[model samples]
Target: MLAIRTKNLGKEFWRQKKASGLLGSVRSLYQQDKERVVAVRSLDLEIAAGESVAFIGPNGAGKSTTIKMLTGILHPSYGEAQVLGLTPWQERQRLAFHIGTVFGQKSQLWYHLPPADSFFLLGRIYELDQRTFEQRQAELVERFELKEFFHVPVRKLSLGQRMRAELAAALLHAPQVLFLDEPTIGLDVVARQSMRNLIKEINSLGITVFLTSHDTGDIENLCRRVIMIDNGNLVIDQSINSLKRDHLAAKIIRVRLEHPVEGLPPIDGAQVLKHKGAGLKISLDTKKLSVDELYMRLRQLAPIADITIGDPPLEDIIANIYRHNQGGGEGHELEQEVAQI
Candidate 1:
């Protein structure tokens, strides 16, 4: 079953245009001008049940706008969408029962109340029966490891602890789909990993996860498919592995030598990014030169103490996509097609 589906979904906002100076501003009071800004344009998307998908884009690229539309926080200016077989805008109250949302910058938990109290409150809001709510609450509390601070006031809990509680509360009603937006924004490394594990477990249990995050770790570790948007248009929709295979033709090689060398030997398709005495960093184009060939050349230059080769980071690959499309050429053909719609 499809967990979410959309066709030509789009959103637009109008803002009052302000004049430059005081005189101009005063004149604009009588003659107000508004400009329409397209936030999301002709977005066609679909997600299968139990699939973990990453929806990522730069700031002001309509990522949040699209989420709001999916969750029924905002009605689309045009097009249609159905989440879990219900029209989000028309059947919002009904759809709320089957979906969960977590916005990192927003808080659904009561600020002054304990998480335990908030959990009960959310259960009531979701209209879960007392026995069922209690049973689910107990399961979530244990699964999320909230025994230590479940009773602590939300204001008193650590960011990580609160995030755990937040997620637990979202799942109180056993939602079929989870919408997470930057869920690990302010968390430390340990906290972030814990949250990631919990989310993975939830998805494993058959909940569809639709996520938007700037953290590459979240995308690389949690999602199998990636949907990249730029300038309010869908740019790429492909599996994570395919994205890497297509755009990641370059490798970074770092070698530590046994002794300092005056000059390094040059190898075809390899450019020295940094060189300082016993340490050298090179950018290798794997298409032109194989790792074995590069290793052979390095061995001829000097005795090697250690060497490590790795692909460019996912951040670099996504940034390249954005930059490539920003140039207004063949790379932006997809976006142009949406604009035409």
Candidate 2:
């Protein structure tokens, strides 16, 4: 089942034309010109139930706007979004009962009160029975490792601890769908891993996750699929691995030859990115040349001391995608060979 789906989902913001100087500003107030900017263009996406999907793009690429429309925080200018069979904007109040949201940049917990109090308040707001609330709270606390700071005042807890509490609070009602926006933005490695595990556990419980993040680590580690958008347009909707395979098949060959090679080997279709002290890093354009051919050419040069071959960084892949799609899905379609699982 598709827990969330959209068709032609879009939103536009109206901005009054800013005047140049003091006189222009004063004149503009009397005769203001407003232009409509499309924050999200026509988009079509569907996320299956229990799927962990990452919504990633550069700043102002409509990640937040998309989430806002899906969560019913903002109404779309055109098109529609249905989450869990309910139209988000039309059935917003009713939809609240089935979804939870966690925004790391924003905290919902009271500053002076401890997390326990916030949880209790949420329980009452959700009308959860006392027994059920206790059970759910206990489970979330244990799973998120909140035993020590569950009672600490939110303002007093570390950022990581507070984020965990926020997650626990968001999941207290066990909503079937979760909307997480930069949930691990401020967390360290340990806390980030904990959040990842929590997200996985939530999805394992059949809760569909819609995550928007700038951090590609979360996407690579937790999400099997990724949706990329730019200039408010849906650029790509594909599996994370498929994206890597199809757009990033090049084997980054790093070699430490026995002799201090004067310069990078002139291998066809390969570009040397770095070279120092008998070490060389070359990015082989796998589509144009095979690894076997490159290796054969290297054998004539000198004995190789050590070599390492690996996939390119996810950040690099995303940057390339952004650069390649600078014209918004219209130019420089660099397709990579699909990698075998």
Candidate 3:
């Protein structure tokens, strides 16, 4: 069964055109000139049940618009969509019963009340019986380790503690599909990993996870698939492994040497991106030279003090995709048939 599906789903808005200066401002009262701005254009997507997928893009890329349409908060300008076999806009009330949402920047919990109170409120809203609510609440509190701060006022709870409570509240009713937006935005390292583990456990229980986050760590740690969009256009939809294998041909390595050298000798298939006192950064093509091979060559040149190797930033990977798709055209259309679910 498909958890979410869309075909040619799009959204448009009309912005009132205004001219500059005081004279233009005065004339705007009499003249109403508007321009059509497309937020999402001809988007098609399919997400299978129990799949954890990341919907990602830069700012103003229509990611929020698309999510709004899916959650029935905003109606689309054209096309159609379905979430869990029901039309979102038309069946919003019923849809609300089966889906859970968590936004890192926003809070569904009551600010003045404790998380326990909010959980009770949510249970009542979701129509969960007393016995069932208590059972689920106990399970979540223990699993999320919320016993330490569960009764504290939400306003007094730390960001990490509050996020844990938020997740627990969202799951109290046992939702089938969980939509998370920047779930780990301001969390510390240990807190972020804890949240990721909880989310993974939720997905393991057969719930579909739809996540959107700018943190590459969140994407790498949680999602099995990636759906990238830009300028309100579908750019790529493929498995995470496929995305890495196809686009991540080069690996970046930054090494700190124990002692500075006069000049480091070059190695085949590796480009020295940066070199300074006791520090060197290199880009290596895995297709031409293995990482171990480059490490061996580097060891002969200088004693390594500290070294770290990983893929380039996610933004760079997306830029590479854009370059490959439109051939570096600024306004070119991305009409290529890329991978899909």
Candidate 4:
């Protein structure tokens, strides 16, 4: 069965034109002009059970809105969506029985309360049976390695620790569908890897995961399929194989010179993209230049310090995508573009 589905899903928000000052705020209550901004336009998507899918887009592109509607967190402005065979907004309680959610930026746990207390509260709210709840909770605690500070106040826990607890809380009921919104945001390398491993394990246990993340590493590592959105519209939806085939055209060559070169040596097969003291970054058309051919050409030139060749990471590719779509405006847009690395 399709674990999540949406048709013509959309969202619109009324943006008020208001000044920043307190006086302006007071005056704007009675004298405000607002416009309905389309946050997400007609978008259709389907994700099968047990599939790890990544939904990625620029800020205000409807990624969050789409997720909210699917999870029944927000009402859609138009069209319909169903998750786990239930209309998300209309049957949210029923849908909640089978779904999990984790938002990295928002903390659902109480500050002074220990995360264990928070988990206990959720168990009660979900009305999980005593045996089922305890077994699931124990499994989650061990899987997420939450014993370090399981009883400590949430405020005393570190960010990574809190994130693990939050993840465990969301999954305590052994939910079938997981919606993770930037779940690894602001996490360090080790923490991020931990989060990824947990997710992989969950999916291995037959949980279907729908994740919206700025981190392309998450997508590349965890997802087999990706759906890209822009301006609230679907831009690309395909297997990772297809995305790589369609978008990745050239490979990057990082070259460190023996000493600072005056100007990039003119090489027939590569174009220098940037120069940094002793390092020069180049892009080569992989179709036209074989590694052996380029190595031979480089060997004849000035001494080299280091050299490596690979594709520009997904972050660079997605940034270029937004640039192609929106004329290169940056902010939350750029933040999402670069967070993948």
RMSD of each: 3.3, 6.7, 5.4, 6.1
Best TM-score among the predictions, by candidate number: 2
The estimated TM-scores of all candidates read 0.92, 0.93, 0.86, 0.85
Ranking by lDDT: 1, 3, 2, 4
Provide the overall lDDT of each model, using Cα atoms, as 2-decimal numbers. 0.91, 0.86, 0.88, 0.84
Give lDDT tens digits, candidate 3, residues 1-341. Answer: 99999999999887677779998899888876676777888889999999999998777778999998999988999999999998899999999999999999999999999999999999999999999999999999999999999899999999999999999888998989999999999999999999999999999999999999988788888999999887788877998888887899899999998898778776888999999988989999999999999888888978889999998876678767755655535543422222211
Tens digits of lDDT, candidate 4, 1-341: 89988899888777667768998899788787665667777788888999999999888777887888888889988988879889999998988889988999998788899988998988998889989888988888888889879999999988889999998999987799998999999999999999899889889988998989999999988999999888776778999878876787778888887787666567766788998777878888767787677767766666778999888788877777876767634422322111111
In model 2, the runs with Cα more than 4 Å from the true position are 329-341
Identify the candidate with maximal lDDT.
Answer: 1
Off by over 4 Å in 1: 265-268, 330-341
lDDT of 1 at 74: 96
Pairs with backbone N, CA or C atoms under 3 Å apart (clashes), candidate 2: 246-336
Clashes of each: 0, 1, 0, 0
**Which residue pairs collide, candidate 3?**
none
lDDT of candidate 1 over 1-341, digit per residue (tens): 99999999999887667669998789787877666677888999999999999999888888999988998889999999999999998989999999999989899999999999989989999999999999999999999999999888899999999999999999999999999999999999999999999999999999999999999999998999999988778989999999999998899999998888888766889999999998999999999999899988888778899999998999999988888877757534333211110
Quote the positional error of residue 312 for candidate 4 in Å.
Answer: 1.1
* Candidate 2 vs candidate 4, lDDT winner: 2
